[model samples]
Target: MKAVTGLGWGALILTLALAPLLAVDLILIYLLEDTPFRILSTLAMLGCFYLLSTILSLFVDALTGALRSFVHSNIPRLIDTILHGTVSGISLYVVLTLFPSIDLSTLTVMAIVFVHLFGASFWLNRENSKEDVPLELDSIDQQIIHLLRTETIVSCVERIQHDYPNLPKRDILKRVKRISQSNKVTEPFHGR
Candidate 1:
């Protein structure tokens, strides 16, 4: 899996964590049935929810990184799932406390979190595992390949990186290596 940056994970987790707050807020607005009070309550609730979600996201990101270093496997996903579940549980408890007559169940909360986490995992994994198709060398790529014949890979990578600051060094190295290997295979077949 492509490693998620702390900021990336933080944003994702914060968004997911807000789901329960939105649900509860809507429920409260409906139950209270007072427009002015609803507006004030919603504003206050949103502020609290935003603050809490930010803190929760940072905690999860730090914990995920720490666990990843220790476990050295796909433990981040497990950590994320557990953290999200805990957040969902806490949110559900708070919602129930505020409105005892609310008809939400623990299972319902779990199901929502599970579905959200599962979908995120599936999407991220799919994106991470996708392989680039063998490139049809464009003019610039061909120029780079030609340069590889006379230049060291490091030199080519440096030159490319200098010219294309947005392109990752590793990607340039991979492309050069792939092009070189393909040339070797074709040269033997073409008697060149």
Candidate 2:
């Protein structure tokens, strides 16, 4: 359910970000032919583009996640921006190539870049700040700690996610690390 919601949001955001280009394409298609058949064709083309872009967005999301895990550290803002721009630009180019009739104008390109830059900066800042938020020892934290005592952090996170679908997995992992470290420090005699 959560994954579906996230995918839906991803599609909506992709649609909004691509709106200008899509509008231009629609107008160009209509101008090429004023008949009802042309209008229907234009709509069909737009639908195909939307579906393609959404799938591409999901691919980008998964790629980003994989890259993030491999790095094992927060990506700098500059690097993050470059990564997003390069990926999005390539995705846009691929999508445009599929429908060769659509002309890529400067204004459409600018709008897409501007939107992508804004979203990337906003997301990076929000992600970086997640670590700063204090984690209280609520029921969830307690559950995380309990699992951490007998399980690896990865398994603990998976269990917590299964039980609490809405909670952020990163936060749960952070809590597990914190609690385990604190336990090691406060109960030094147990290790010996």
Candidate 3:
């Protein structure tokens, strides 16, 4: 599996966050008689759901990335889906509580929406992963890339220990600095 780029992550998050809210809004409009209170309440509920889903998505992504090495990738993905489903379930429950006039059948519909959202999110993540190719680097080159990406010498040293225990930190730092300097050449452009 490959890491999702920052733009891909943003797009996925926005889609997962907004899609269900749009469904719920349409359902609310259809089920309720036209009234100011119903419209206001539905708008409020949409706002709350959007805010919660955005925060939850970001938190889940970070948590899954941090735990990447400890567990199988699918495990975290499954856990995130379940957690998102639970959030949807909670939102439905809250709506039901606030508006007792809504029929019990609405819960079943909401449950379907929850399941659909989970599946969609999982599918989106899978598709995004397909777009990325894992970075290929030798051990020393990996350390150098890490240093350049993170701009943290200490993290580079720690990465060396974790990935190449026998390699000395000083040697890695020296080679990374040399590579960094050598890659900084500027050339004047000529007409083709």
**CA RMSD per model (angstroms):** 10.8, 10.3, 13.2
Colliding residue pairs in candidate 1:
none
TM-scores of the candidates are 0.37, 0.44, 0.44
TM-score of 2: 0.44
Q: Compose the digit string of candidate 1's lDDT tens values, residues 159-188.
A: 878988888877777777777676442322
Deviation (Å) of 32 in candidate 2: 19
The residue-by-residue lDDT of candidate 3 on 149-171, one tens digit each, is 64554665666667777878766
Q: Which candidate leads in lDDT?
A: 2
Flag regions of model 2 displaced more than 4 Å: 1-54, 138-192
Predicted structure 1: lDDT? 0.59
Error of 3 at 80 (Å): 2.5
Candidate order by decreasing TM-score: 3, 2, 1
The C-alpha local distance difference test score for the whole of candidate 2 amounts to: 0.65
Error of 2 at 53 (Å): 4.8
Ranking by lDDT: 2, 3, 1
